[model samples]
Target: MRLPSKALIAILFATAALPAAAQDTAAVPQSATAAALECGDDFATWKQNLANEARTAGVGEKGLSALANATLDQKVLDRDRAQGVFSQTFTQFSERMISDYRLKHGAANLQKYGTYFAKGEQDYGVPGPVVAAFWALETDFGAVQGNFNSLNALVTLAHDCRRPDLFRPQIVPLMTLIDRNVLPADVKGAWAGEIGQTQILPSDYLARGVDGDGDGIVDLRNSPADVILTTARKIESRGWKRGEPWVQEIRVPAEMDWALTGRTNKLPLADWAKMGITNRDGSALQDNGLKAGVVLPMGRKGPAFLTYENYDVYLEWNQSATYTLTAAHLAARLAGQPAFDRGNPDAGLTGDAMKALQQKLHDKGYDVGGIDGILGTNTREAIRQEQMRLKLPVDGWPTDELLADL
Candidate 1:
């Protein structure tokens, strides 16, 4: 593992410097509108007030004009919801992210950007394949960065009730960038308003983005170097350790303690070695003096991993084991490593079964929200609550046995 480059570090730090005031107003669009309409009794006047607020926040006359002209379409909202549903499942999400297409393309990227990766490795201490894997996952090698208008998406989400406080400030920066011609007024991106090659949020881009290609403009959408380095910078900022492995496939002893799994507990390498934990190849644990935890992502029967701080660093990038696993697997493939020996068993569940489970949980007074078969946060939380209520292991996972009982 290599350290992040100074330039990349600077970019990461700058990007994370979001204004506190902006965070205060980050709400989703529809929810915001509903709140305003309810409180003010006038939707038109409420929108005007929002526009005036944008102007006061330095969105500028031109940006405000564009925003005023922009209309919220139900179709965009529907599309976003559909996409969001698709991303909820770890099994399905990981399968696509770590698919053969990504692995093949990631390997090709390593070769295409060999010099860049080599230099990045030396200068930033970030592995080349790791950087490439992030690229593959974020935007599919820049092929499908998204199609939603960046401003519209941000404004919509900000005005919506779910997370208006988090997205409110983004509107100002987005508008300011457009006003300054740093970004086009009609910039397109993911449904959540993230833009460019690395899927960076507008606020992050405004603060931390760099012209890594030295083109005098930090265009994450078009500049590979900027996107790659910016990602490396984010990893570094999250405290990725240099010269250390993120995770290692391990052979867990059949009789070994299973209580050590997850991030809750850690043991020194010496302690783990004393406890008879070894690498899959039967090698001893490294005497690196660092603490690590066991992670059985699938279950007791599945492959286990001894995860390091760098694994946590990767988690900080996406906060999902599925996303981190896909990135790690892709990185390994890019480095010519073999895929995991086992496949995901919980790969798919029929829509009907999902809906049934959702309804059961909801009937039991667990807030699964409407039984739509879409596994969003509410559904997962409800599942966890149900598991706890049933005295089952609280992994928040859905299984055939659990569904049958329900």
Candidate 2:
């Protein structure tokens, strides 16, 4: 795809060319006692403590001052919670996300930055399609990075008890970024403090940035070379294997052993082939020792994929099955795979009905995570167990009959 015009400017480091004196101009407000950043504490008190923590972490005066200006955003928490599950089926999500524009644009990006993408693969082992898929998904190739104040998003998320362990560590890194003049204090990004075109958090942004262009700076928001290489570096650091397959669409027989389905029962590709697994176009299975699992997103009858070892990286990037699977499928599409076969899967459950099912499963001593209606990994696992017990199809999708049986 053509590089979005907005990405050509160095807005990420708008202050990098300025003398260090001009950056981080905000001043930390004075406080009598540094309170611990507990969830229920007063907002003003908690903010002061946040600044204190940043200062103790060696954040410079301006970084700490910027922390002082953070506002408590209720919407950040809502957004984070809302992302607990991607309830759409694989076909639904993939069709919506992988649009004609994205398909055409992603192909263009492969040709436009062929040299850099090849170099990234040579350096980091992640292929062009994999990295570009995330680049497209995160911000639509930099066209729609969020408008949330990243500072506020970070601090707001850091204070919430639900994910303090995850967001708290990000605070120091972001302040350090601002202090280093790598990012402006008021830089806007996603609601989760993700910066740049790939929507990376400040922690990853700080540690994994790569200067792909020979400009002596790492500006992921501007340079496609930088984004391409830095994204590869990030994925590599997260355990990507070079020249290995991540996902492949596959077809499974109807009368197979249901117990061997899902990612939980990972076996060699040869074993999966023995169980009547074949490629989507009716080709032979790998017949080798690659760890393979069947992912029937809607159910046994839905679109299926044979996931490989490298597929774990997608899970690490985002835990939602729908999102990760769609991303993997989109990467394959960007690499010239045709559209997936939307099989005649059984009807899925509504959100409210799913929540009720989860509650019933919970009452039956099955750990469905929570009664939140989102079919997360734990809930899906529980449903599979119940499906096995009920002698139903063992795909993870919780059906109405599965709910009624529970």
Candidate 3:
């Protein structure tokens, strides 16, 4: 998730900033060379380059001053590197994150912000539960928004060589917020430079934010109305379809073609029903034209989900499969669905074992999307392919036997 500090050895060497006439108007430039702010550049010179970028983006003197005042924090780099995998299975993660407190508050919030929820849905087509699920999971309904200095975090990430492509663009919007007095110059938020109750990034905040309370200010941190509406807008902007299912619990047959599973391998519900894939209650699945994938988060003998298009929105919010499932399940729970059946899945491989398995897979003509030790969608796809090749169970779980076979 982060580059090694040793790769930035040249950061101690300062260089002159690029002339403003040469820079483009993009919030973040496409090339480091275009801005003359290489990963190897010194920190002080990098800040000056960032100020130049902000200035070209139409930021005034005040915002330019905020950009200039921003400092690179090594602690931010440490956190970015430490941003790692969710090592829990679906059941364990859901059980932990969907606490009694969140359930109670999430339900109450549905009523507390009922007006805004309805308005948000009417306007943005995202339901209250979907938005509220994110609200509950991120920062606990605004109770625990991160305390890291937002300015420092943004500057630190933009200056860092690893993901400057992502963080660099966020600087202008953040400075814009400061310039407009919507946020202070020294705002505090998440380690990745996200702000507000839902921990939204500055770009999303700028693009999707709205003044929901009608007070003429988009105050996401303190106003429930603003938080609810703004979150709905963001989810809707991420391709959330109106009046569609996100995820539903399902019971798969004891024996079936596991190759038909995974998010990308979508099949009509009628076809899945022919394979005896039923609702969680053992009832026949509705033969609707809706297409869904049978998602086995912990392999075959584990919690199964019929993931629909709306589930992609959850993935967009956070890419971790465990976290995505937990968020979707929490949304369902908030909307009055019963608890999911926990199946006795086989134990998964340890982090080291998973990384080793990934390396082996990568070596043998598979793209596991880097050996991060996390079972992302691409990693799962590679595991399924390898399992099929080896005539294994093909459940997409990295088992010890699979490792030994490799």
Best by lDDT: 3
Candidate 1 segments whose C-alpha is farther than 4 A from its true place: 1-47, 83-93, 118-125, 273-276, 343-406
Off by over 4 Å in 2: 1-37, 83-85
TM-score for all models, in order of appearance: 0.75, 0.88, 0.90
- Estimate the lDDT of model 3: 0.78
Identify the runs in model 3 with alpha carbons over 4 angstroms from their true place.
1-37
Decoy 3 TM-score against native: 0.90
CA lDDT, every model vs. true structure = 0.64, 0.75, 0.78
Q: Answer with 2 or 3, whichever has the higher lDDT.
A: 3
Deviation of model 3 at 379, angstroms:
2.2
lDDT of 1 by residue, 239-306 (tens): 76777777667766655554445544678878878878787778987778888887655544555677
Name the candidate that leads on TM-score.
Answer: 3
RMSD of 3: 7.1
Query: How many pairs collide in each candidate, listed in order?
Result: 32, 2, 0
Provide the lowest-lDDT 10-residue window in model 2: 15-24
